[model samples]
Structures are given as structure tokens and as C-alpha cells.
Target: MTAFQQQLLDVNGITLSIYSAGPDSGRPVWLLHGFPECWYSWRSQMTALAEAGYRVYAPEMRGYGDSSAPEDVAAYQILTLCADIQGAMDALGHTDVCMIGHDWGAPVAWHLGLLEPERVSVLGAMSVPFGGRPKRPAIDIMREANVGRFNYIVYFQEPGVAEAELNADIERSMRLLIGGNSDVFLHPKPADAQFLAGLDVPTTYPEWCNEQDFAVYLRTLNKHGFHGPLNWYRNFEVNWQSTEFLAGRQVLQPTLFLLGEDDPVGKLEAYTVKKMGELVPRLESHVLSECGHWIQNERAGRVNELLLEFLGRHYPRAGIV
Candidate 1:
């Protein structure tokens, strides 16, 4: 693996801390992390891709880690978030590049492709797949789907409650998320139950995530507060409005969808995947067993294998230094 360096770039009034590796002359790739996670999430991929001759940049994203954290909720709107990615691209002066994202970052990557298709080469998403916007209101869709255990999304819409709960017990929160602390976050259930139950426990990770790593997340989120990250959920209406025209927009670029079979987030109804496939006509889906929501960590080897193969298929390495 090649050595990666950390640098800060001031793009569009926001200063972003970016971790980058690989050859300076190689094709550039940007990896975006989701909520409750920072640029560290892509540490493995950054190393591997960099070694494979791609210039990879993984940013902490605004409101996470050493990046700017604006207090206003509107600051985290989808449009602005999309601009952050574009701004980063512009700052690097890269006209087009390979883009990969997970969870919240996946949606932003989707928006980036839609808003500026010419700027993106190929797309790779983990855990979350594109299903366009909800046809009916999200509430109506949830109620109709009989999604009982996943009530946290609706609860998060209330504001203050989740932040309060998460802040009250950072260790406990980390425990629930990583399956390290008492195997529970708030309630008493098996370490795996929280994830399998389909609740939006951002902290509920697997055992590989320990105290040292959890503290990194807690420190950043606690300092920034959950409002900015939660704002991603609050922008459903805005996303819906902006993406209405994308009802049947096809993502023509080569795409990859990686998920874990045990991932509650990935265990949505069949229609969701169907809708995603319909929208992204070129999507190739893969599901790994014995894995959960944190697919990248739980199944790094397999994820790396898939990513390497996909990139090779689309952008073969020819005669390049």
C-alpha cells in the first residue's frame, strides 16, 4: 500500500480535510463516507486503490471530523451537499473521475451524477442503492410497507430527541453501533438484534469496531451535534422536489452495488431494489452473506475484490506510467 497524506482545501466557503493516496498522474477517484463516519471509513480502500494506481481522495465531508460544521440546518441541504462534492472536484481541477459513496454519501453521489453527469465517470455505492424518491409521502410509504421496527426515521423527524438520546450515552451509542458495548445501544437485545431489527441505530456497528474507533466518531459527532447529519433526513421534501424529474432517469454510467445480506438497511422490500434497478439501468448488484450494514468493514476482502474487478472492467489499465 502506498502512503497517503492529509491536506485541507478551502472550497466554496468550506474547508475540507481530505485524505489522498496513489499516483499523482493516475485517474482520480473520490470516496465519500456516510453519517457517523469520517474519511477513516475508507482507509482500507484508499490504500488498496492507491496501490492499484488510482488517485483516491476521501474527505471527511462537511460537518464531520475536521471539516466545517455549520449550525444552520439549511446548510446541510442536498443541493449544498452535492456542491461540496463538485467543489472538491473543481478544487482538484479534475473534469471527470470515478466516484464511490456509502449511505448518505451514496445519495449525494447520485445527485452529483444527476446534476453534473459529465463530471462523473463511473459510480460505485455500498449499503445504499438508488430508488429515486418516494412516490407517495415517506410516511405513507412507510405505513404501507408495514415497516414497524424502522420507526426511528419518523422519530428522527421530530428533532432533538435522537440527538439527546445519542449524546446522553456516547459509549453506549458506540456499543450499540459496533456491537462492542454490552451488545446494545439503548435497549437490551443481542448485539446483532439492533441491526437486524431495522432501526436506524447509526452507532450499531459490528464487533471489529472497538473503543478507540468509537471514540473517534463520538468526539466528532458530539462536537458537531447530530443536527447537521440529521438534516439529511429532514430534506426528504427537498430531495423529492428536486428529483421529481428523475422519476425514470437512467444512470447510464457503469455502476456497482455492494451490500450485506444481514444488513437491515439493505434488507428493504423487493420493490426498492426493483425501483433502483429500473432507475439505474446499468447497475450490477452483489450481496455478501454473513455481513451486515457495515459491509466495507465486515467484508473488506470481498468488497475489495468486487471493486477491483468492476474498475478493471470499465477502465482497463493500458499503457500508462
Candidate 2:
């Protein structure tokens, strides 16, 4: 595996800690991680892609690890998140890139495809799919759908409430939250339920994440706490309202979407795949059987294979010229 070179750069008024590998001359591949996770989440894929001669860059997305965590809730809005990556790419001097993201990062990647089609040569997203900008604020939609139930998004709407519970015990929170399946969010809970109320803390880590990997996540959350991350969820309505200009815009880039069969998020968002197809014309998608939310980590080998195959076809290293 190629050793990662870490650097910090001021982008979009915030400093981002970027972990990069592979040759500087190789085609740029930006890996954006989701909430509660740092750049370390893409360690396996980073190694594989770097070894395959594709320069890989994974950043500790705002609020995680060494990246800047702004105090204001509005600072974490979706467009601002995309702007952070855009600025990072500008700082790196890369105009064209193969951009990929997972979970919350998926939305950023998808939006960037719309916001910068010519610059993002190819796009990939896992776990989450873009179904186009909603007609109304997403918070309103979630609230109506989750009425009389405990929806995590709705639960995260209150500023300090979820932060208090999640930050109470960083290690325990990381353990239970990462180890648990997506059903925790998919299934209905009482309206008064807390985020980590009844989840069990695993004595041993999952196969994809060992004690060492677990330690990295623990140290990260303990550093910045969950305020910045939870702030992401708090901006659902804000994101929707601000992105109204993208109402009918489609992400015209050659795209790939991956999902895990067992991921309850897939169940909750089954309709999105179809909508994504309508919104992303050149999209190629897949569902890895028996996998879950942590698609890249849980199925690193297959994910890398699919990514390499997809890139070789549409955004190959040799095609950069």
C-alpha cells in the first residue's frame, strides 16, 4: 500500500486536512467521507486506488478530524459543503476529477455533478442517491413522514439535544453507532426516543473495522465532538431552500451508484434509485448482496473492483490527456 501524505489547506474559508496518495501526475480522484467519519474511512480504497496508479485524495470533511468545524449551524449547509470540495480541488490545481462520496458525502458529490459538470469528469456515490431537489424543505417532508415517531433526522433537528447524547461518551457512541445496522434509523421509534438510548456497545469491533481502526474514529470524535456533524443534519431545510435554482438540473456526468442489499437506508430510499436514473442519465448502479451502510469498508475488495472497472471505462488514468 502506498503511504498517505497528509496536508492542510485553507479552502472555502475553512482549513481541510487532506490525505493523499499515489503519484502527483496520476489522474485525480477525490474521495469524500460522510458524517461521524474522517478521511480514515477511505483507507482501504485509498490504498487500492493509489496502488492502481490513480492519485487518491480523501479529506476529513468539515467538522471531523483535523478539518475546520465552524460554530454556526448555517455554515454546515449543503452548498457550503460542496464549495469546500470545490475550493480544495482548486487549491490542488486540478480542474477535472473523478469525484466519489459515501453517505452524507454522496449528496455533496451528486450536487457537485450538477454544480460543476465539466470539472467533475466522472461521479460515484454509495449508500445515498440523488432524486433531485425536493419541492419543499426536506425537514418538512421528514417531519410529516416521521410524525408520532422518532426519526433520527428529526431528532437531530434540535441543536444541542442530539449533541449532548452523542457527545456524552465518544467511544461508546462511535462503537454503537458504527456497529449497529441501518435499521435503527429505518424502523420506527417512540417520538421521545434518544439517539443511542437502547443500542448495545459491541465488545469487539466488526470485521471491517478492528480495534486500531476503531481507535482512529474515537480520537476524531473526541477532538471536535458531534456539533459540526449534527449541524449537517440540522440544515436539511436550509439546503432544500437554498438549492432551489437546481430544481430541474440533472447531473449529466457519467455516474455510478452503489448500494448494500441489507442497508436499511436502501429500503427507506428505494424510490430514489429510480428517481436518480431519471435525474442522472448516464448512471450505472449496483447493489452488493449482504452488505450494509458502510459499503466501502464492509466490501472493500468488491467496491475497489467496481470502482476501477467503472473508472477504466469512463475516467481512466490514461484518459486524462
> Candidate 2 at residue 122, lDDT?
95
Candidate 1, number of clashes: 5
TM-score per candidate, chains pooled: 0.86, 0.98
Best by TM-score: 2
* Per-residue accuracy of model 1 over 37-127 as CA lDDT, tens digit each: 7777777788778888888899888888778887766677778888887888888898878888988888888777777778787899887
Model 2: how far is 16 from its true place, Å?
0.7
Score each candidate by Cα lDDT.
0.73, 0.89
Best by the lDDT measure: 2
User: Per-residue lDDT for 1-321 in model 2, tens only?
Assistant: 579999999999999999999987889999999977888999999999988888999999999889999989999999999999999988888888999999999999999988988889899999999989888887898899988988888899888999999898888888887887775566667989997787777888899999999898888888899999999898888888899889999889999899999887788889887677888899999999989999999999999999999999998887552
Instruction: Evaluate residue 172 in candidate 2 and report its C-alpha lDDT on the 0 to 100 scale.
Output: 87
